[model samples]
Target: MRKLILLITLTLSGTLAVGQTTQKPPLHGKHWMAITGKPLAATAGSMIFNKGGNAVDAACGILAANCTMWDVLSWGGETQALIYNPKTKKVIAINAMGVAPTGATPEFFKEKDMAYPPEFGPLAATTPGTPGGLMTMLAEYGTLSLAEVLAPAMEMAKGYPIEAQTATIIENQKHLIKEWPYSKKVFLPHLGEEREAPYPGEVFVQEDLFQTLKKLVDAEKEALAQGKNRKEAIYAAYARFYTGDIAEEIVRGTREQGGLFTMEDLAKWKVKIEEPLQVNYRGIDVYKLQEWTQGPAMLQSLNILENFDLKSMGYNSANYIHTVYQAMNLAFADRDFYYGDPAFEPKSPMKGLLSKEYARERAKLIKPINDPEIGPGDPYPFQGEKNPFLHLLEKQNEVIAYNNHGTAILGPDDPFLESFLAGTTSIQTADAEGWVVSVTPSGGWVPATIAGNTGVGLSQRMQSFVLDEKLNPFNVLEPGKRPRVTLTPSMALKDGKPYFSFAVQAGDTQDQNLLQMFLNVVEFDMTVQEAAEAANFNSYQMQSSFGAHESKPGAITLNTQIPSWIRGDLKKRGYKMDFLERTSGPLNAIWFDWKHGTFWGGSSNHGEDYGIAW
Candidate 1:
């Protein structure tokens, strides 16, 4: 065990160095691999792979470990994953996003004179979907037992050296932590004394959380003793959290704190497995989740850009950047206005939105100069229905005002943005047999205050729901409806086989970064590592998906690596540009070269992300 940890540390040191400007080669392996935001979490996933477990098993381990190690990814958060089964020759989208509680209503917040749910309190929490999501993946797709996969994460919760990034996040949110005694007890140092945040290298322990995870393991053992199979045992373990004492404790805590979540909501929550939406670009089929996420926006943008010769425009050229930005703006405009819970409105215009014909029509609006007020297209015209938000899609001459008051943006010096930009912990694993998994497990961090002594936190995802019922019926706060989230994981298939799996963590930039990285490889012909390290740009031209739903029309942020001339040229073209020290989001990916029987893995250097292939 000591040797394994040592080897992982050395490998991670090398991998981290590659994220710098030196351009180190991608990590290559012939069998299997795992890459994630944190070194310890990656090590956990790699251990699962080394033990002969498949990609789904490795991903379960990775998700558990990430929840323990990174404050940004909590056990109580939601998870949106994409899995590809080589045996079935199919891709499945897992919508593990939590739903608003029954009591979550527009009138509930309107009485308080607030436009949205509180960003960091019990009121912001919903029924957590991560546990159900992980257990479901294990029961349906993985070969390993719950006890086996959760061991590493339990060990991490017992005591692990705090990483610099996690330490900084703790420090930044110390004030919020201080607000809840249980939260402060779990995250801060000297619980009731000086209240110092943990620093890098300090051993951090969450004994309560360790015990909580242990209960799940014990429940799985009990189920197995009752003659249940591995799958049934996994489901039994999920029940322990969702329908047993754990749920009771969470309900009591939230109710005591004046929150709306109830035991009924927790018991009824289930992760949905649905078909993924795909679009072929350059013979590669790119897949993303449907309406409940910002994923389709990327597919729409790709569809529009597919009509242009991006290669001729030159990489990062003003023409290429402007075109991509305009296309993304248009897609995001549609996302804000149209995308929502399909369950609430089964007639979501997804088919028409992803149609190539719609993309072509939307592309016609792109001009040489920046169009500051690009709005959602008439998808209803193509879908044979009336567009409900058409009236709200008015264009304005002035740049849309940015309401930054309730946003999560801490400040220029705050690590919050960089923490997310470093990307959430995304895990990808492809075993020797060709089973592939791409899972983005996030939520339950700084903005989400911890629940009482249940050893569980809650997600602030309720922030994504709108209080105005008139904005769009699809996104209006409603019981049992999932909010349109920004957590998107992507997969690509070539020749009917899994080619690559990738994801990013930044809110609005998640799909944008995915699209850019995909093109960087397929169109620009760059290696996985090179594509991740390459200069990248993201636009904020459309309304943000987070708190307040503010828009910064024509706003774009460019990596410093982009040449000065390119920035100068973009500015000359009426595009609003800002310089960032590094890529706006961290991109993690694994590329499978089936013909050569090799796996190449890469991750962004922006944060503490690392990749291990062996």
Candidate 2:
């Protein structure tokens, strides 16, 4: 009995010691880190880094795993990014946004009088650019074989335990899953009287996805040899999955359900890469994906912030938050009014959207505590400078409310209605250890009830559009046109050296969230972990807490940690208010500890994702 008791005590001590070591005293190495919205996705990226892959390779691995983990953001969806090449001291933009099908047009939608069918599912789908995007990056910069890089994802899809966050996502978005049989199978297999996720510790498999990737690897060498038609071996494989066999299955299933996707669309689709938008912020150059997303708008906001004394205002204080939101509203107003893809309009305003003079003009409209209603400002004219070449309009118009019925402002209905009306933003970041940022690509809360010509439901990409008379809304849905997105994947450079890479998910709120977070680090001088974990407000026009987009009433969100004194002071100044118990945006980030040559990364616990490094 004495010997047995001693043995039991020894076993308990051993377990405790193991747990202590597992806590990990911060990893040290030259690593390529990936910070994404999911733990499994991050794990896949870290594995690639461990296997001698670069940031690009890690990103591909993460993208694949993310598709299986969260259907809303990957697989046949758009992907845009900013990649930094330390060797050349240049940042490359991988613009994998889908192009408008040659068949899309504004007139087409107007003819139908349907407020641009929310483009989600098959008919609204653009040729998925991920294949081309990943391939292009691999062909240019990757050292690992594509087959090797893709292995982790194949393994993940075949079967892995579902994480707590992913399960919560499944529960929250059950409606989207119930719409289609395949979606339901992957999301919630019917379990005796009700649907439930594959239990934790149970192997979850995506046979179709796994089979599809295997086919790609088996034929990659042959596919590369021929431009149009690859070597027969690879060509046959790609056709069987993408066009011939698997394509037929997708088409048949879609048709039975009522979708507009056809095998021809998949066969004819190709990825398009365009010039990235560039801007200057306080002598530092910034780059982002073009107008199809709100990338340029982030550049514009930074440009405006450069004209202000953010560091002096203090971090997360009402004063600082006010300035940030004002800048965001001004930029977003321009976004709603002018931003869009250049190929369609040929005269889009994105080119001059981030001009220093333009930012200056936009900054002039902001009064310290005046609390002007939301729509009473414009960026171009506020800069206090005039353009000689272009005829600029001087407008400070107050917009009418969406309905003017004075909707009830109290009770559960109010919050529920507001939450329903807002959109979600995703964040991605890359570190000096090769971490990167890719906030998920879609826009707002889509109407799940509306089915596309393809039996699949539409995503809320239409919320990106705003009805503006003078400048064509950049977010308008044209069949072949990519909508203007707000996914801002960014890299920070200090003294021309790459400092960090970060991205957030929050639709139009992306720039605002990023701006506050960056200030939390650069201005407030907080530690990387603190900057990543700190609660911040996004002053963009999405959440009803900021009043209506049309109202444009100035407001600021306060992290609960903020002192009540600061909140009361801001309220006295007439700033409208909302207090978030949790940080509103999901931030994934990585910083290169230049001093130690190590990477420290964190994925926000506020969101269900995990941050990973090797």
Candidate 3:
């Protein structure tokens, strides 16, 4: 009877989202499942999975296809991933995030009369990381050759029917794309025509990009001919990208466009495989990338919420909503001040920041009304050390107030929403063998500057760095330092086995929605699809990581479906509210059904995210 009502409610509008649980039906895969931001990318994963590759190989395939299609990313972006190694029974973290070049410093940007890095152009690029990340993951864990893994993307570069999303993005960004000579040549093929960009179904050919891909493949083939093993051959291809002709062209192109990249910056950068951070919520162990990313914020939120009986509060009720919002803001407050690259000096208090006791102390400060002035707490004491940056934390709000003068304030409904919007996508893959991989690869969206003739887009992740120590002493930009990023992929283990792999693309709101989605599944017993499709809320209380790096205190965005009573309750609690039909997500997930020895995949209809299984 409930399903009938849902069917009627949906059919009245138009065609179904092809299938429906929340528009898309839950897909059950007995063998394997591949899901990503675009249907074509997911198909690439399926193509590899069907060819006997493991989850890691298929994931690498999808990553490559996503880059080729430019689904909010390009070859020169960054990639952070969480992989469950079935043989080792441990989750591993892959940090392929690029770092600041030799001349990148707070003084350098401030000299340009800027508070933070620019949003576009060569000056905004970081060292390329996605290519290295893809090769490293495939060489270490995949069974197929590099040529086989990149076949789909190679075909795509040669020529493929363009989707409306990419076509429109290219056309709209043509003005900026024209600024870079190489990008102009590649993205605007019909410059003066009525529609400079290709039509929706027109074949978009990237001959230069095809040659670049061909060079890497050729490098691998030459290495194999010289008797190199599969892994060694793959690394040979990797070397050609970073230190050979490809690197030379990239360096020349970026420098010609006034970028900071140098041969040293590209060569010195390498992928890091480290242990993932984890916090047990109830019996489920949730894992996230370390402090270098905002991933730990989600872990911290779970710690605070674990103190409450969320199941009793009921899902999306006024009380439940309030508790979760307070927890996210509390966690993000810490993220803004304390998260940075652990590889650098004055290491962040990750121990204390992720401490459960510290979360309890922070939760004590939550009031009935939103406290707009909520500042960073002293986590060092929780780790048995004195706070080294106490003075810095004291004047945090004053610094924010000063920065707000330069910040742009836009309402929630505006297309140019100031906070919580980034160009990114999530890749989730799992197979029958217990191999699971989750990734949030982003940067180098459309309007990206193409480096020389390489056809590789440069990452604009440099804007994530702040030039002032007063804002984030831990994250102040310097040569070879990684800026604190909002990209986070997630994994969960149940009773020492891979239980779930998930991620979403929403900048600062990434963890806020992820926290609610986790609770929706664990506390409320919703299926993976239901949890993913659930309308979660967003709090614009924390500062934006991009653009002007502004914050909107007490501002909240809610789904229109919330009852008037609940809305009034929130209003009475001093929340400034705004409503939207779809307030959150493009979240993708895969549940490992251990008992049944199968996988359940969920791709949100809120976006172009799609999945395939058999």
Candidate 4:
């Protein structure tokens, strides 16, 4: 409904001479932008854009560079992306997430004397989806070849100076790295020398990783030389990783290490391009990856919040935070209960969960004070069926005792409990021609063993799956079933035109942080930078989507900048509040103002995030 106005008014009087006047209008230009949680990745994407490539090309480059940030991203991890093409006026979602091995089963883990798959070994690894995902994007929507975009990342793998955060992460995981020979060989110092973590200025190199990437580039070259077109060459590169020697090495190493990945699994895995799930918030259309990820949680929360006047509630106020927390809790409740890979579902539940009427009905259950246990809604009523998980949902109300491995004691003193949170990196790119992309590439984090000498590590994503046999229909272990990943990227359009692209890199806190940033822009009318910098809070009132699926009812953590009075008000309203030195997640955003012909971008300054506009 808001439109940019451009006009000049002039008045003439009964004088001998006439004067003309004009009003200054907002300046506009074609904008090229890129933002990421790391400076090098942002620079890499900008380089691609500067070289006359579109957003898809820049996105490929950015994702490749992100692999170097081993502290926050994984070289052999999974990726999910949303790309908007101005040419076709269509938005596409890429589900490049990893899947469970055919041999993975609860019975297998139980037989091995484990309650669940070990989180740091070969048994925890899944078939990586990044290579296929990136190549598919290049083949379909990208302007440059894979080798061209990946050149910067290959150089980074050859050698680069370590950063402070990465240094700290490596130091913390040193003990775990020592557990695996290949991991120690690649990440730790030599066995006989004084084992020390790489310092901030110290050069860190991964020659093996460099060679692995070069192999893919060589495959592309070979294809090109064989008279194949660019798309075919890209596929050749993908095959090199998924169906060639790389796949063979992964399968062999996984089997040797007592894992279950097979050549057939690798051959069958491919990135799927599907339509993004969307919801209308105000006049804007927000898009996210489907239920396989936690992306729809943001949309569901928005749909619930759309019932209230967020602007009147005031930003970050007790009422505002409480309202958002309540909505988020409800949405997450549904996320935990119903979200899964649609390929495995008997029927799609998204149509019911995304229905505005369903959101309104769910929102009516929100209380001024946090509900002790707000379970998933009966979305199936809209689908004309009884809720299938009603019994399990009711059972979740009873808190289960957690067996802390390191500390038997409960409370803040438990070392195992305190070390639960983690972070990731996000990248967003948009070219002047209006091709936009938002990607969250993650997995293969530390404590996980590298796949033999291939330089590619396996993702521990299988840990996100529920081991309970009763929950098998949703989020349970199954061959080729995608994990219910917390990685979510977002895009929005105003008046059916591309408006902004955004994503954050925190586990369960991702959608929470994204919702806050988005509302800051649409409701509080903050600039992209101001919105990203604003104080934020995360609610842990529902079960986490990670290991053990812990839930802390009525728990909320806010940035220290939030006023004490607001914190006290929330406490008075029956909420437990905690404060962190800074916000939980690192966020990145790129906004395009079509009417003004301008692009604006922002990245969190709290971490190594960088935003570049040209």
lDDT of 1 by residue, 403-451 (tens): 2223322345634334334345688888888888898877787645666
- Extract clashing residue pairs from model 3: none
Sort every candidate by lDDT, greatest first: 3, 1, 4, 2
On TM-score, the leading prediction is 3
All candidates: TM-score:
0.93, 0.80, 0.96, 0.91
Q: Give the alpha-carbon lDDT of every model.
A: 0.81, 0.57, 0.89, 0.79
Clashing pairs in 4: none
The candidate, 1 or 4, that scores higher on lDDT is 1
Residue 158, model 4: Cα distance from true site in angstroms: 1.4
In Å, residue 447's CA in model 2 sits off its true spot by: 11
Model 2 CA lDDT for position 613: 59
Model 3 agreement with the true structure over 481-576: per-residue lDDT tens digits: 988999999999999998888999988888988888888889998889988888899887788888888777777888889999999998888788
Regions more than 4 Å wrong, model 3: 1-21, 400-419
TM-score of 3: 0.96
**Candidate 1 runs further than 4 Å off:** 1-24, 192-195, 394-423
TM-score of 2: 0.80
Which candidate leads in lDDT?
3
Q: What does candidate 2's lDDT look like per residue over 387-491, in tens digits?
A: 332332233232323322242222324433344324343434444534344435432122232221221222334333432333334455565556665556776
Candidate 3 residue 461 Cα shift, in angstroms, is: 0.1
